[model samples]
Target: MTDPIRIDVWSDIACPWCYIGKRNLENGLAVAGQDDDAPQVEVVYHSFELSPDTPVDFDGSSADFLAQHKGISIEQAHAMNDRVSQIARDQAGLHYRFDIQQHTNTVKAHELTHFAKEHGKQLEMTERIMSAYFLEGRHVGRIDDLVALAEEVGLDGAAARAALESDAYLPAVRADQEQARGYGINGVPFFVVDGKYGISGAQPAEAFTQVARQVWAEHQV
Candidate 1:
């Protein structure tokens, strides 16, 4: 068997574009090759905080959080969020409920993600976390909440809860951030393909396909 292509994804759970980028990458894979002929790829998610300073329980709505955090008017924040939400719905097929989203720190959530990775459920946990935050209006900052979500994805709830409480994967999250800094990545949904090619932002599916096919051709040579 040939080696699987490796893709390192640096993104935040709160970033809507990250999810959009994930969808685009999937579409790109479908365009790149068939189920049998497609290059084997492993997507490893890393931690990035869009708002590291966000409180565990923000006192207001997502709009209020954005306005206060970015020093913009609530009206402006709502408009921006609306535009993003529309894009998610139309282009990405993701339902984003920013109005009800819990604006909180994602450090612990990243920790849970690392835990899920250790248990071989990282992808499922990552998707579930993003969906819970963006679509289901779940508060991902709390340990109890995260524990429940972990269990929903076939992980041990109590173990996940204990890990979070202990900050078990905090170092891994920090290390991932340090690596991002080393790579000079300051944004979410950044993709590093095969440790050589870098794809930034929520690029179109064609972009991913081109990169995937090009990398595969080179890798096969």
Candidate 2:
């Protein structure tokens, strides 16, 4: 029997494409019908902060951050975000309000994800964080906000708060960053399929489907 496919995804909650990439991956899995027969693939979400140096309370919108980071005009940044927002909407059924976006460092958010993983609710936590950032406009970089989201997802709110306050999962977040660097990854929404194939960006569902099938066949050796 073939081993279960292992998928490691490196993403950040603040990244719109990460959510789109996640949906595309799910669509691919559904199209492949691997859920019917295979010992379902194992998916692990890794931390990848797009704006590691962002302040806890960013003073400006996402446009401001992008403009500063890329050394471009606000108009150009807005145009770029608008295009990505449109693509994300079509791919993930997400509505990104760039104007309301609170650009903050996601390091603590990633640590909370690690805490969720310990409680076997990593995926749920991931989804909640993504939704909060993109759809609900929650302040993801704050400890209190993260604890509330954790409770909403059925995790221990106090524990989550403690983890954030004590920086408990900081090591796990660092490990993810080290792994990404080891893999030569320098971008968000990077996927490693079956621990062998690498897929980058918010690829088309068909592309993901093809990779899933290919990886499955190879594992069947």
Candidate 3:
């Protein structure tokens, strides 16, 4: 019998393509799991922040941050964001409101994801964080906001708050970062399929489906 395929995904909540990639992976999973011969796939999400130096309370919008940091005009930033939004909307069913998104550091958010992983709710936490950042425009860098998001996902609000305050999952977050570095990964939305194959960017659903089947076939041989 072939072993189940385990995929480790390294991504950032603030990354627009991460969410799109996640959705594409899901779409691929649906295709891959259509037959009894399909390999059972297990997914694990790891921490990867795009902008570690961003302030918690940037005195500007997400577009403003992009404009300043990327050395582009505000109009150009808006155009870029719009293009991404259109892709996300058409391809992933995600509504990205970059204009109102809070540009902030994601380390704390990564720490909270680790916290959720301990409770076996890592995927749920990941979805919520990405949705909050891209769609709801929530402030995920703040403890209060993170705690609220945790509670919304059926986690203990007080425990989440305490975890953040004490930096309980900081080490785990760092460990994930170290692993990413060891793998020579320097980008977001990167997927490691069965610890062997690496898939980069928000690839189409068929790509993930093909990988799953190929890996399964190789394992069974």
Candidate 4:
């Protein structure tokens, strides 16, 4: 059997573009898979916190946070978020409710994804957490909330709770961050295909499809 093409993605759950990129990558893979002899692919998500110092219960809205973080006016932040939201809806069919988003430190959420990885539910957990945060305006920083999300993905809620409370996956989260640093990755939603091809930002589906085809063809030769 041919080896699957491995894709390592560094993204944060709080990143709007990361979610859009996720959908685009999926769509791109689906397009590539239309061929009967298309190579199989494997995706591994890594942690990259966009706002590591953000409080679990932030005192301000996402717009306020963005304004301060980017040195922009609150109105500008709102406008920017609106533009991105419109793009997400039109391009990826993702409904992002930035107005109701609960911005928080995503370390715990990242750790929860690592725990889910141990049980082979990492992808499902990541999707559920991102959807909860971006679409449902749910709080993902708290342990109880994360455990609930784990259960939603068919993981053992109690074990998840224990892991979170004890910080069992914290090391893994840190390791992922350290690896990101090693690669000099300063942005979220970065993709490293086969540990070499680097694609940054929320690129279109065609970009991913092209990379997949190129990498697979190179391997076959």
Best by lDDT: 4
- Taken over the whole model, the C-alpha lDDT of each candidate is 0.91, 0.88, 0.91, 0.93
**Best first by TM-score, ranked:** 4, 3, 1, 2
TM-score of each: 0.96, 0.95, 0.96, 0.98
Return the TM-score for candidate 1, rounded to 2 decimals. Answer: 0.96
70-150: candidate 3 lDDT, tens digit per residue: 999999999999999999999888889887899889999999999999999999999999999999989999999999999
> How far is each candidate from the true structure, as Cα RMSD in Å?
1.2, 1.5, 1.1, 0.8
When 1 and 2 are scored with lDDT, the better candidate is: 1
Model 3, total clashes: 0
Highest TM-score scorer: 4
For model 3, what is the C-alpha lDDT against the true structure?
0.91
Tens digit of lDDT per residue, candidate 2, span 1-221? 56778899999988888999988888877788755554357789999988788898989988999999999999999999999899988876778888887888899999999999999999999999988888777899999888999999999998899999999999999999999999999998999986667888989888877777777777777
Which ranges in model 2 have alpha carbons more than 4 Å from their true place? 34-39
Pairs that collide, model 1: none
Candidate 4 off by > 4 Å: none
Error of 1 at 197 (Å): 0.9
